[model samples]
Structures are given as C-alpha cells and as structure tokens.
Target chain A: MKNALFVLHNSADTRSSEFATLAAIATSIGNAGYSSDLLILDTTGSSSVNVKHGSAFRNVTAVAPDKAVGDGADYLVHIVGKAASAAVSLVVGFGTISNRNWAPQVAASFSAEFVTACELIEVADNALRVTGPVMGAMVQKTLSLGDRNAVVLYSGENLAAPEGTDIVVEVSREPAEQGAVRFVASEALPDSGGIPLRGASKVISGGLGIGSGEKWRLIEEFAAKVNAAVGASRAAVEMGWVPSSRQVGFSGQKVSPDVYVAVGISGAVHHLAGIGGAKKIVAINKDPEASIFKIADVGIVGDYEQIVAAAMRKL
Target chain B: MDIVVLIKKVPDPNLPEQFVSISDAQDEVVLHASSQYSINLYDLNAVEAAIGLKESAGATVTVVTADDASADQYLRRALAMGADNAIRVELDDKSRRDSFKTAQALVSALKQKSIPSLVIAGRQSSDEDAGYVPYLVAHGLGIPALAPIVSIKSASERTINVGKLADASIDEYELTLPAMLLVSNEINKPRTPGLKGVMAAKKATIEVVASEPGGVAGVPSKYSPKKGQRAIEATKFIEGSDEDKAAALLAALDK
Candidate 1:
C-alpha cells in the first residue's frame, strides 16, 4: 500500500487548525487509496503532546521527546528527513513559519517535487493530483506527481476528519547536526485580542473606504461583538490605520474564516485572493458598484458608519 | 562581509484579472498589453534590508536575479536603490518557473564569485509565488535559512539578530555568518531612489552569468483557474432601515 507521512511541529507559532487540517487531508488521502501516518516534532521540548488523537492517521509519532531542538531549521529538517526516508510516498506540512522554513529544504534533500500553498489533493489512477495558487493568486494550477515522491504545504483549514482508530508509534532518532543559528528571545505583542486571523471562525476587515484611523475602530468593535478577528486591506495598512500583521492580501496573511465581513473594502484582486477560501463573504461598501459585491454572498450598500452603528446598537 | 540580495521582476500585481490569460501552450498565465513589470514587492524589502546592513556594518550590497535580459532594467533600478553591483543569471521563461531548477541556476551563479557571508531574499516573489526558491537555494548552498522576518534587531561582522512576528509574539534569532534571510514587508519602508542614484544606475554596467543545467525541474502537470464563476449573479442585498438591515446581516451570519 502507498503511504504518506504528515509532519507537524508543536511550536508556539504552529496553529491548532493546522493539525486538524492535516488530519483532514490525511483522512482524505486514506479514502483515496493511500495509508497515512503523523509525525509530530516537538521543537519546544514540551513533555506532553497537546494534539489530540482524533486526527485520522493510523499511527502518530513525536520526535525528540526529552529535549528541544527548536532554534535551527536545520535540526528540524534532519529529524523530518530521517522519518521521511522510510519509503514514504508523500510528506505533508502546514504553511506555518517553522514548516515553511524547513519543509522545502526537506523536499530538496531528496530531489522531491515541492508544492506550496496546496488547496487540493487527491490520488487517482496511481497519480498524485495537487492544486495550488500561482502568479499572485491569479491562477490555480494542478499537477500530477506521477511516480515521484512529493512534499506539500497545505494552507486550508478545518476539514472534517471522520472517526478513525489511531495509535502511538515510536520512531528512531539521531543527534541533530550542529548549526550556527541560536534562539534569542520571543515577546508577545500587547494584547490586541479577539481571535488570531488565520483560523478564526469570523473576520471583520476594513479598508481605505472606512475613512480614517479613528473610524477604523468601528471595524474592531464590530469584530469584538462577534468575537471575530480584525483584518485590514493593504490600503488601510499602507495608510497607517492598521498594523501590517493585521493586513490581509497577496502580501499579507491568507485567511479562511467561516464568515468574512469586508467593511468599506473595494475588493482589490490581491485582497480577494487572501479570502478566497472563506465560506461566506459579506461586503459593506458605500459604492454600489464596488468590486467586493461581485464575490460577496450578501452585501449592504450604504454608509459604513451608519450600518456599523446600527449593528452595534442591535448587538 | 559581503551581502547578496536576490530579486525578481514580476508582472504588475494591481492589473485587473481580465488582463490575465492562459498561455496558448496552456502551461502558464500570460498578461495582455496593459501589463507592466516591477521589482517583486518583498524583494524591495530585501533590498532595503541589505542596504541597511550595508550602511550599518560596512558591507557591499550586490543584487542578483535569474531571468532573461528583460530583467536588466529592473536590476538597474536595484542599483539606483543603493545596491553596489548587480548580476543576472540567464534562464528561459520556462526554466524560471521550476523552483528547483531556478535555485540550481542561482547556486551555479553564486559559486562563480566569492560566496558572500550573507544572503537575503524576499519571502516570495509576486509572480508564481511558489516561495520555495530561497529555501531551495539555501539547501543547495548547505546553509541555514530564516524567513518572513519582520525586523532586524542588531547586526555585527560575524552574526546578525532578526525577528519574525508569529501569531501573537515576535520570535527572535541570532545567526552566524553564511546564512540566508527572507524578508517580509514589515521590515522597513523602501527608499525611493534619488536623481543622482538614478543617473548612476543608468550608467552602471550589470554582470551577466550563465546558469549550470542540472537539477530536478518542477512543472505543473496542468494549469487552470481555481474559480469559474467569480461574480455572483444573485447576490442577496439586505434592504430596509439601517437597523433592519443589521438584523438581516446577523440572521445571515446565523446560517
């Protein structure tokens, strides 16, 4: 039977939804005629694995249980490479920072084909079918990894994994090759809380059409009422109304929230590309012909201030 | 210490989607007459980072690219932005799309000269956006790599300090010489070239290098648009009093 290995790193930056999404993909691969396993690398040196066993893998394994090997991407690549060399057909990882740092290197080690930002994966007729965005999200290209081992980075979220029997599996390890990189420190930004953007169930974003930095608070308040993450268009970010971290577009974060509310956003192609995976889009723009309305499931044409104020009072 | 920055010239990202069309060969997307080319956005950040390093630590900043001769104008622009020198590795449009092959080509070009102590690149180019080339190039050079960095905390001759914004925190790292850093847009505001800088760049000569041919090539088996129906025909517009419309929106969310 053809086998695939899903790689996960239990790091502070690794999102929980990534675990679930990979599990979902694993389940899908299983149904598509491939056996799947999970390799969780604990870079943070945590004693207990926080990820649940509900992931749809036949067996899950965690590497470097006793100590942290987190500082260098090379070490993670070494451990992942060791596990990946055991006749695995596919190596999958999330599009998180650590994964992005090392996953492609692992692919390069074996001269494997590396696919980034994968939105679709299927196995049929002995060919591995993969789809991902290219050219600044203008086009989606599908490729056949025919008779070649492949490494893939998945960016989608919250796929359902049917119930399955899962068990723990142990793998052999070796000391990481010494590298010159060292971890210095990590400091959390001052609380700007609602929810993190990547996996939030709902997102409320504002753009230049929102007017000024003062009025940007409306988007934040509305998001708080819905317990949603706050996002911004590149225009809003460029205007100094929102932090670059909160910017959503081709150059910023790619979000797949369940419901996305675009307030005063004119729907630039780059901004729309970031939210293409959102299940439903609601646009609020004063301009009746705003491009945002073209892809929105629901739209309200009026002054955003009045509409947001009304929504606030109702809430 | 010498610092090398990798840059790419990409089709204008702000152009409307209607201008984008699948090539006649169906292997890639091509833009129409209105398309213009500019240096990839994040690479500008990379250039700014290299220039910052050059200013602070007294290092020469060299910008390198892997594209055909059309990229020379963009390379001159990088020169205007304070890059001390520029190099172009010749690769056909088809070879440039294969991340592994493109990286191999870069590796060959870099090996032609004295390898720089540091290399900086954009997190991803605006076009293709595969984001694998830098890491692959790092792998080929057998060096450590860090990416999507938000800021540089400190720099010295032997090592440099950098930070990347995580979900909520900024993760910092210190790396010794012979490392790669992929910059994010938050790193620094790129400076506009002055008239003198532009004049100098116009007269500057760019070095052209030949790429060695041997690495795995990655071409998509098929290429197409992700969505067929971009514009929803029957978008439900909530119409009523402001409060009533708000109520309708809330109800829609409940679905």
Candidate 2:
C-alpha cells in the first residue's frame, strides 16, 4: 500500500495550529487509497503529545530535538530531514511560514516533485490528481502525479480538525549541524488590537470607500455592535487605514468566519478569495453593480454609513 | 556584492471576472482581450527591497526572470525602477509554467556567472502562486531559504537581519550571507520611475540567455477544476428602504 505522511510543526506560543487541517488532509489521502500517518514537530520540546487523532492516520508520532532549536530555516530543514523517510510515497504539509521555509528543501532532499496551494488531492485508477486555484483564485489547475514521489503544500483554512483516538509516540533527536539563521525575537503585530480575524464567528470589513483612516473607526463601531471581527479590503490596507494583519484578500489573512459582512468593499477577486470559506456573506455597497452582491447571501445597495447606522441602532 | 531579484509578468489580478475564464480544451486559463498584464504585485515589493539593499550596501542589483521575449518590457520597467541589470532566460510557455523546469533553467543561468551574494523573490507569483521556484533554486545551489519577510532590519557583508510576519507577531531573524529571501508586501512601498529613469531604462541593454535543457522533474498529467465544484450564483438584492434593508440583513443572519 502507498504511504502518505502528514506533518505539522507546533510551537507553544502559536495560538492556532493547523493540526485540524492536516488531519482532514490525511483523511482525504486515506480515501484515495493511501495509508496515512501523522508527524508533529514540537518546537517547544514538550515531552507530552496532545492531538485528537482520527482513523485517518494509522499512526501518530511527535518529535522534538533535544536542544533548543530556534524557529529558523536550518533547524526546520534538519527536523524534516530527520523525520522524512524514503518509504513514504507522499509528504504533505500546510502552507504556513515555517513549513514554506523548509518543505521545498525536503522535497529537494529526496528529488521529489513539489506542488503548492494544493486544494484537493485524489487518486483514480493509479493516477494521482492534485488541484489548486491559481491566478488569484480566478482559475483552478489540476495536476497528475503518476507513480512519482511528491511533496505537496496545502492551505488549511478549508478543512476541520479530525476527531477520533488520542495516541502519540514521542521521540527526541539531536541537531547535528550548526544553524545559519538566528532567531532574535517575536513582537506583537502593531495596531492590531481587537478581536482576531481568523476563526471569528462574525466579521465586518471596510474598503477604500470608507473615506480615510479616521472614518475607519466606523467599521470598528459597526463590528462592535454586531460583535464581529474587523477586516479590511486590500485597498484599505494599502491606504494605511488599517494594518496588514486586518486585511482580507489573496495576499492577506484568510478568514473562515460564520458570517462576513462587507461594507464599502468593491469585491475584488483577491478579496473574495480570502472570504470564500465564510458561511454567509453580507455585502453593503453604494454601487448596485458591485461584485460583492453576486456571492452575498444578502446585499444592500446604499451608503454604508446609513445602513450600518440603522443596524447599530437596532442591535 | 550582487543582489538578484526575480520578477514575473502576470495577468492583472485586478481584471474583472468577466475577462477571465477556463478553456477546458486548452487545459489553461484564458484572459479575454480587455485583460491587462503587469508585474506580480508581491514581486514588486521584492524589487523594491532589492533596490533598497543595493542603495544601503552599495551592491549591484540584478533582476532575473525565465520567460520569452515578450517579458522584456517588464524587465525594462524593473531597470527603470532602479535595478542595475536585467537578465531574461528564454524559456517557452510550457517550461515557464513548470516550477521545476523554471528553477532548473534559472539555476543554469545563474551559474554562468558567479553565484550572487543574495537571491530574492516574491513569496509567490500571483499567477502560478506555487512559491516553489526560489526554494528549489536555493536547494539546488545549496543555500538556506527564508521567506515572507516584512523588513530588512539590518545588513552587513556576511549577515543580515530580517523581520518575518507571523500570525499576530513579527519574528526577527539574522541570516548568514548567500541566502535566499522571499519578501512580502510589507517590506517597502515600490517606487514608480520618473522621466529620467524611464529614458535610461529605454536606453539600457537587457542580457538575454538561452535556456539550458533542464530535465523535467514531474509534469502534471491533467489540469482542470474539481469534477463537482459548484459555481457561486448571483443572489437577489434585498429590496426596501434603508431601514428595511438593515432589518432584512440582520434577519437573514437569524436564519
């Protein structure tokens, strides 16, 4: 049977882990007729492994280096190198910062084929099919890997965490090579005060039409009224009305909120890509022809300030 | 010292959805006549970072890309924006689309001269969005790759400090010389060329290199949307006065 290895690198300080998505991916691999296993790279050097394992993975293992390996590319490469084996037919990872820094290097280590932004993977009659949206999520591209080893990177916002057994085999190893990069420190995102955007139950976003940085407070006011996280279109971010962390678009944070509200947003394809996972979208725009209305469950064409003002009063 | 920045020309991401569609027979994206092409926005940030580094470290900046002759205009734009030199690796459309082949071709071209002191590219091109080429090149040349950095905090001949954006924090790192760095948009605001720079770019000569036969790693056997993917249908606009619209929107949330 073909074997697939799903790997997640965890840090104690990190709030949201891609464990759920990795588990979900492993299930997809299993459905495609491949035996899947889970490997967690614990940067915290914790001896205990706490992951809700599902039937998707046949085995789960947690690895930590004996020495403090700073979150650098060299150490990540070293860790993945230690865990990856020749017998694994597929190596899977999430497209996060730490993984992106080293996953390709591991692919190079084994001379395996590498693909990124992988949205779906399935096998039919021995052909490995991998599909992902490219061109700002405007089009989808599918690739077939025929009996060749592959390393694939997937975005995790689309899938839920797997549920089942709780078992992990913990192991430790030594870093044999000296590192080339040194970790200095991590600082909080500037001016990113308020509810976090990702995983928010509700989101309210503003765009260039918000007028200016001062008026951006309206978005916050409305969001507070509805208890929604504040989000911004790329134009708003570029205009410096909000921090990049608050931006929602192809290059910004991807949010999968239960409800996403767009006020004064023109609905660029890139902005729409970030909110694709939202369960319900409500668009408030002055222009009736705004693209946001197309995908929105409910759209109101008028001055956003008036509508938001009315909604705030009612709330 | 030499700093190399990789750039790509892609269909303008701002193009309306009506202008873009999938051609099933061709197994690729097709842009209508009204669509436009520009430098991948993220790569523009990379170019800006490279120029800033060149100005600070007194290094020569070289912009490199693997594409056909049509990409020359974008290369000229880079030079106008402040790159010292530009090189284009002549690869066909098929080869250019394949990340492995593109990396191989770039590796071949980069080797013709001495290895650069630093290699930089956008985290990913807006088109392919693979983000695999730079890392592949780094691996091929046996250098470490660090990416999505927001700022180059400090720099010296042998080492450099960079700031990377994490979930809600900024992670800083010091990388040794001869590393690969993929820049994010937060790095710097890209500059527009003035008349002087534009005229100079028009007069500047671009170095063109023929692509070497880089063996294929693995090509996709098929390219298409998922079989059962659903297209998002247009929704009906909620009708009524401002007060009624607000009520309807809030009511819809209740359901």
Candidate 3:
C-alpha cells in the first residue's frame, strides 16, 4: 500500500482551519487507498506522541525537532506558515531526497529549489502537481503518479476534497512562538525605497512600450491602487528609465506573486522566468502577437495606459 | 578583510526563443551559435556588493567560479569591475554539478586556499533557478548564511549589519564575520567595467584550479516541450476606442 507523510506545526487553536485542511487531505488519501502518517512538531517542548486514527489518518506521531523520519514514503507534504524563514528550515530539514517530486509552498524561499528538483506539472490556487518527466507536450493531460514519491507543500487553506469524502479528524497542540529568530540585529535600521518585490502578493510591471521614463508613472499609479510592488523589464532598466533593482527577469528579481499584471510588456523568456511562480497573470499590450498573452490567464489587446488607468479607477 | 564572491556564467536568457532549442530527449537545451552568454545577473549584483564592501572597508575581494575555460572572460569582467583576484575551479562538465556538488567543490577549493571573512553569492542562478548553493556551502562549512539580502547597512571588523526581505517586512540581521550572504539585485547596482579597467583585466592572469572528484550528480532533467493550448482560443479581442477598451479591461479584471 502507498504511504503519505504529513509534517505540520501543532496549532493552539482547536478550531484552526489548517487542521481541517490536513484532515481533508488525509481523508482524500485514505479514500484513494493510501495510508497517511501525521508528524506533528510541538513548539512547547512536548515529546508526547498522540496517535489519532479516524476516517483519514492511520496514525499521528508527535516528534521532536531533532528526530528524523525514515525514508521510503510515497509522498511528503509540508504545511507552510506566514513565517517564510520557519517554512524554509522545515523544507531543508525534511524535504531532502534528491530527484523526488516535492510541491513546496508556492512563494517559499526554497520554492525555486523544488522547481529545479522536481518535474512541475500544474500550479493551482491551493495545490500543485509534480510527476515524472513527460515525453511530449500533450493537451489537457492529467498527471497521475502511480507509485512515485511526491511532495506537496500547502498552507491548509482553500482545499478541495474528493467527491463523497467526509473528513472528521481532530488534533490539537499549543502554538509555539512564530518566526525564525536565527540572526539578531545590532540595531534597527532605517527603511529605504527599495521595492519589496520578493514577498509582494501582487505586482504590476511595465516595459519599454510605456515609451519614456515619465510615462512609467502609470505603472506606479496602477500599483498604488492595488497595493502592489512595482516592477520593470530589462529594456526599461537598460534604457535608464527604471533602476536595475526594479527589473524582473532572469537577470533581475524572481517574483512569484499571486497576481502579476504586465502592462505594455512583451514577455521574453528571461522575463517569464521571473514570473514563473505567479499564480495568475494578466497582460495588457497593443500587439496581439505579444508572447505574454500565451501564458496570461487574461489578456487585453489594447492601450496599456488607458486600460491600466481605467482598471485603477475601477479598483 | 577578505571577501569572496561567487559568480556563474549562463546563456544570455534575453536571447530570442528561436535562438535556443531543446534536445529531442528533453534533457538539455542547446543555444545557437549566435547566442551570447554572460554572467548571471544576480551574481553580478553579488560582485557589486563585494566591491561595495571593498570600497567602504578596504576589503580584498576575490571572485570565484566553478566553470570551464570559457568562464575566464566573465572572471576578467569581474576583475574589471573591481575584484582584486579571480579563480576558476575548472570542471569537465559544469552542468553536472547540482547545488550540493557545487557547494562541495567550492568548499574544497576554499579549504585549499585562504578562508575569507565573508562569502557572497547571488540568491539563485537564472538558469537552474536553484537558491541552494549558498546555504549548502554555509552548512558544509559550519557557518551562518543570510539570504535574499536587500541591503548591507554597515560593516565592522567583527559583524555586518544587513536587511533581509521576508514575506511582508524587512528583517534585520547582524551577522558575524566568516559568514555567507546571498544578495538580491536590490542590494546595489553593478558598475560597468570601464575601458581602462577592461584593458587591465585583459592583461591579468586568471588562476585555474581543478575541481575535486565525487561531486553529487545534478537532478535528472524532466522537461518536455509544452504541448497545451498556449493561449485561450476564445479570447475576446475588445475592439473600440481607448475609453471603451479601458472600461472593457476594468470589467475583465473585475471578473
């Protein structure tokens, strides 16, 4: 029988939705005839192991931070939290096993490593699929991992269960202090205007099609309306229209925001590399043949200035 | 103080897609003869960050890479950009080195030479997009690693103050010497190599060292040509005046 292991932090809130999500995933795996193991990490220094078997999980094991799990599991799932540092440490510690499929948190610092190590299939709002290599490009292909080991990183929110499956597993633990306080600062530093593009959930970027540096204000104006970080293409940066720090491409920052809006930007492979992790892409360009349209969830073939301005107003 | 910067050479990703082709086995990508190759952009920023330290604190910056003879040009470019020295850890096939293997090779090279007070590398390489080498190197050397650093606020003999960008806020860290830092492009703008510096670089000799054996193999390639419908077939092309188009786009965005 196939086995799935889930690693999650013990939350103090008994009604935590994350626990529900875990139960749902466990139930789905059980319904599919796979055994589920839950490895819970307690921040309160408790070494007690609580075994809970319900409609979903077969066993729940509480483990210490230093304890290690045995290999040969068919799947590994890591539930990530808001603290990226904490999430990354867990991934590095337990997500080891080269060439295995792992679906880490979409925006985690180590997400790129997972992408490089695994065969990424499709990225959705609540889940992502990773499987063995595909032979040729096929349309509407559904990936099924018969027996290969797969790793999925999820936050335990917005999960969808299989049909006719009811999850009713309850597990609770104390919430430990959040954030990985690994490094201590000497003193508080002043903030600069450096764009926080790394963690931005929404990004609005522009390209040379905006014409001049002055006209780039449209991007900023639109970004301000949506509270998004501003980004630029290499062409704009090379033209001295924007700082290189704002450049988003293979040569610049790699961003995986939830929503990426590209205005007047013709998508190049370099530019697409930076936005590969973006959940939803919206492109606005005058050229219908612009490469950005190929990957965009929604494409608008029109004047970016007018469309962005109107969209900003509507928002 | 001694600072070491790690850099990599990659196919200029800005090249048109037509200039690049994937192998039939879907295991490799071949660049056309006309395709140009250059330093990874983030690695360039790392070089700049090291140079900035040298300018402010009189640190000696040495740039290193695990590449072939073709990497000498980029090493010279780093020299022209203000690195004090360059070392290329010559490998038979650089593509075979994964993050673990690359870190092992780099650590081996460092053990053979002087250990610097600080090591700097780009957060990740654009080609593989794996931000693992820095942390792996740090772990291998038993040192602290701070990554995705946006800025280095200040530096002293013992510690360096820096800012790390997290999900929503900037976290500050004071790292002791003998640490590793993976910098993002927001750290600083890389200076261009001037003509005089370029001339000097052309004349300078790059030290070459052989990489150690038994490096870990790279992840197996699983890329296949995408065969799905790239664009939505029923995409509605709104045709109207700028105002009408703007209204249409707003509605679409709302949807």
DockQ of each: 0.59, 0.55, 0.23
Candidate 1 yields a Cα-based lDDT of 0.79
Give the C-alpha miss distance for residue A261 in model 2, angstroms. Answer: 1.4
Which lDDT tens digits does candidate 3 get at residues A164-223? 333333334323222221344322222123345645778888898999978887777767
| Cα deviation of A223, candidate 3, in Å | 4.6
Per-residue lDDT tens digits for candidate 2, residues A1-315, read 788888876665433446666777777666666888887777776676676653458877777665544444456677667667888878898655566667888887677777666767776665577776677666767777767778888753566666666555565655536567767777777544657675677888999889988889888877776777899998897677776668786656677778888989988777887787788788889998887888887778888778777877888
lDDT of each: 0.79, 0.77, 0.60
RMSD of 2: 3.5
* Top DockQ prediction, candidate number: 1
Q: How well is candidate 2 docked (DockQ)?
A: 0.55
lDDT minimum window of 10 residues, candidate 1 chain A: A65-74
TM-scores of the models, in the order given: 0.89, 0.88, 0.69
DockQ value for model 3: 0.23
The CA lDDT at A72 in model 3 is 11
Candidate No. with top lDDT: 1
